[model samples]
Target: MYWRTREELSLENRLRRSYYELLRDELDQFIMAHALKESYENFKNNNVAYPFVERKELKPRARIPKDEFSLHNSFLVIFVEDTIPQAYKKYIRFFDVNKTTKTNLLRSKTLSLGPDFDRSQKFLDSVHFYHFLKELLPVDYALLIQRDTSHAKTKHRYYLSHFHVRIDWPISEAAEDLARYLRYISKDVYEKGEKYAEDVQKKFFEYHALPDMIGGRRTAASVAAQYLRRLPFISTVYVSSSESRSLYRYCEQGVSRMVLMRLTTGEMEQVADRNNMPVRELKRFYMLDQNGRGGIFLFRVTYGHTAPAMPPEDGKLREIKPELFWITVKYQHLLPLPGIWEHPPLRVNLIYT
Candidate 1:
């Protein structure tokens, strides 16, 4: 028998188990309500079973894992697999380097403008606005295509639009990883000072930070909790790099304060195990509040896909897809004592599922 220590058992795994348990019962009721068993028997005897619902070996690629650990952190695999068309593969490779280089240079120049520059403020404002709009739009991917035709006598144009597509996986890890990649790419642009660096920064910032800014830290936690409540079996939400800073700061102030004042070493270890990280490792600190309500906050947000708006129609019901993005929050607490202190167990109270 495989035995998992309490610390080894991830919250995501537990949640996945819970989710499946719930889903199994629901599926059974659905089968019973539709007389699926009887219908299946009849079809087997009469050769009338609908092919759509017939049991078939699921292709390995078609199935999604119910637990978070099995989920890939980044959507690169799926994006390369699903969204990239066969015809564009060559073109994508050709433009990959130059496009990346240009985007990086642009970002660096904008950030170089010192903190007080109007251009920087405008850049931040634009980022916030885009994020606001993103919340209203539902999209799976945003593609950016740029082509230049000046080389040919006929002025043939070649352009490639960057595509930002949503990862359909329900696991937060997928989104978190995607967000981190976006930020990493943007940071490169920030360093390079490319022509489109400003635009890239705006987009990256919007995709990763706007949600928390709009709703506040508490609201973000609530959102995460709601996802947890939906588990039919076992599921766990993994906070990404993007979310770590803010959430850690928030939790330290809100919950860690209480825990640190009273909890013993054994209790602290238990909490660390529950969080799936070592107690000592979690004790490092980064940010500090003036009042010392929370100390040592180190967090970063990762960016994922932000969908573009759809064309409007006169009569048809227009469905706007919610912009799907993911963020991960990581934190290490610092105590006023001689040594740093780890955060206590967090009891996230979800508002509405």
Candidate 2:
């Protein structure tokens, strides 16, 4: 995720991408909607519904909507509950004046008025608001509005840019080819029912965008993509949840975290169906071991391919297969990425279909 300004590539109009950030915010919502729909019978009006912000002016107003309309914008939520509940109490202070001194040590404070005060000028009601939003975002627009991450960027206008990725030495075709083949084999190991399937759907089904392609700036999807920029640029194929926890523990032992990345969002949206006090904001970060230079740097090179890679001898290998790259790191490599294989999605041509 940490890169010099020049290393980043332009995916579309403005956003650059890394492999980890597979799903965009809108697509995340769409995927959540579809995922929840499968088990809608168990959901309740309160369990899934929440207030959503529609406008930002004086005392912003929010519209409460159904469960589907309230899904959080997170591409990755399986390992952890992407949504967090936070409470904030707002108060207006009133100072009491003393009769003699005209000053007071005590003050009275009261909670402010509840949200649901005003409506967006664009919509008549919550139903109308969501209907308008749903219609405004066509399925095709949501899917094709931008592109997904890819190693080859020039050919695919929508593919995420990746020149920032660094490797210590020259890469070979055999290594790349073997990686693809192994990734194919590993599919059976990862196909662990619902969780794996959902991740696959998001990895392949959802669309990705360069920050600029959407708003000339980085969005949640574009930022989430940075997680791939960590020491291990390779896919998390070999590392299970427990393995990753171990890596974190190791990183914590005396490895002074130098904030290599920081993400900030100006907007906040209500996160729950209850009082609309605690809202969600999009933020991401990358903490590098500033201490790594003195200890040692381990270049964890693994043959990683998410999709099958064709042989370079094949005419369309480059077109259909993913390219190989290195993910050098600051400390001893964690989670053995078997030298056998690991990678990212194919170019847009085969990916979307």
Candidate 3:
């Protein structure tokens, strides 16, 4: 389920939630008032893509009477104005049915390439459309399709896995808008800040190189073996100060770290009892190295099963909210430390820049 901080229930969240809700509500009403049906044939085949199927072109086995040809899927066709030259109209269709194999309940559809659609713009537009529909219609699953023919190497083709996001819990209108805005800002920044983007990529490669650095496969397995050796007595291990220092630098540079631990069924029970949470509820656990001051923040493990987790009271210690949790975990855990501290790792001084 989605989790939200009480602090998130602010004016900003409320306004954004209202804005999209109102827009979607109005769109829904418009469709109903017009007696829109789920199925229909589009005769306007002005572009080379999505060729029209005339009666003669219909397959004998698939052919159906015109009266019986009702569209079984609900769709929203978005016509986007071009902000760049050589880009004509961009069409994004939202299908209200599950076509994705992983999750069967998500809204999925393909984006058709309009005449004069730029290759770069097509890709970016697909990403933008994915984020837009994600906020407009929150769902547990969503996908975007991008088509392009301009590339000299890859011919006219469809990019099926452009972007994806799952919204398992209900979100306030404001939170949704904030999410969309963040996505837009990130894309804008990446497009504008060439140096910054390159730096991030470099750091990402460095982080991936860690597994090789520590001792190739042998060293990596040794790290795992070290933890496995201690698994009998320790339910968890906290990162030491020195490791945290290294981790902080990596995080500042955008690396990621994973906590390795094996919990006994009894230890898990104790953890559940202590936290007043369920055993099956535990998914991914983490410790945050706030800034460079060596402060540690323990996060309840919540598998990427739903929205971010809500923080507990006091705001200092809480489950990672679904939205921010993954971002924070993937980036924050990069801090290096001395040793793995046990459960309730000692809190360090709070440091915020």
Candidate 4:
């Protein structure tokens, strides 16, 4: 082919350059969003890190790792602006990268570098979305702790693990804006600062039935082990403080617990005879220890099986809810494992400042 004149070639090059620059300016209009860092003052540790994601940092979005139960119904409303000169685009088009793995909400923005742009102003931010995930993780995790999946066949109780109340960001419309808003569906989560945990937990405990407990001290670990060792069979004991109303610092301390003990039908009858009342009419169940002098509440285990005999891992306790933080037992007379109080799963505290 005949070579084009140098003048013509230069003109062509100029036109191409101008076209490319226009595309660059248009692309700059939308800024890749990132999570802003904020201090979680309520956290006992104080100053937790919040993370945000950006466009340039998303090339490997597809390969990003995900966690289990990551698709839980965590939804949020993200408000973006429409502006010029790359101030920031108030909105992003819905970009579904891995429809099978709908984890990251920024998938579209990250993938837009190739051939995808849905310019829609509104979109869904599910639990798997990483960009703004950190902003609401505490609230979300707290919701999980109270989740009671107990059904007709399976009665699993998940008490609130650890929740730090957050007042930042506008969450009033969180339910209306998203279809998968978990707070709306959460039976345990109260509307903003309400002491709902106590009511929910009280009902759960009364229904499921917790074992009666013996008094405790640091040395009680050994004492409890020795006591349960002589029992006819292995006994599993669950220990947890009563769920207290949170959302405050320095909760006015009071007696919030009852030590319950497990006994038998004949034992109840004997106690009733001693108390001079029918077993059904007996108001109090606690009586003396082995010597029969000290009063201790009685809780006959109704279910054949007990909850997990071991302490729940950090992930289980990370959610905010009310339940005993400590549990111990003498299974075949083994030394008691460290309860949550002894070996805390999470450092975040809701009752104390």
Best by lDDT: 1
How far does residue 307 in candidate 4 sit from its true spot (Å)? 37
Give the runs in model 1 whose Cα sits over 4 Å from its true position. Answer: 1-98, 101-281, 284-353
Error of 3 at 107 (Å): 17
Instruction: Give the backbone clash total of model 4.
Output: 21
Q: Once model 1 is optimally superposed onto the true structure by TM-score, how far is the C-alpha of residue 179 displaced, in angstroms?
A: 25
State each model's CA lDDT, in order: 0.27, 0.20, 0.26, 0.23
Residue 1 lDDT in model 3?
Answer: 11
Question: For each candidate, what TM-score against the reference?
Answer: 0.18, 0.18, 0.19, 0.15
lDDT of 3: 0.26
Clashes per candidate (backbone, < 3 Å) = 67, 14, 31, 21
* lDDT score of residue 43 within candidate 2: 30
lDDT of 4: 0.23
**Worst lDDT window (10 residues) for model 4?**
245-254
Q: Could you give candidate 2's per-residue lDDT for residues 1-353 as a string of tens digits?
A: 12323244455422333322332323333332332222232233347532212111001011112222323221111111111111200110111121111111011111112244222311212233333233322211111122222235432223111111111111122222222433422333233444433332222211121101121111222222222223221211110011011011111011110001111121112111122333221111111112222210111211121223222343232222212211112231211111212221111110111
Q: 202, model 2: CA deviation in Å?
A: 19
What lDDT, from 0 to 1, does candidate 2 have?
0.20
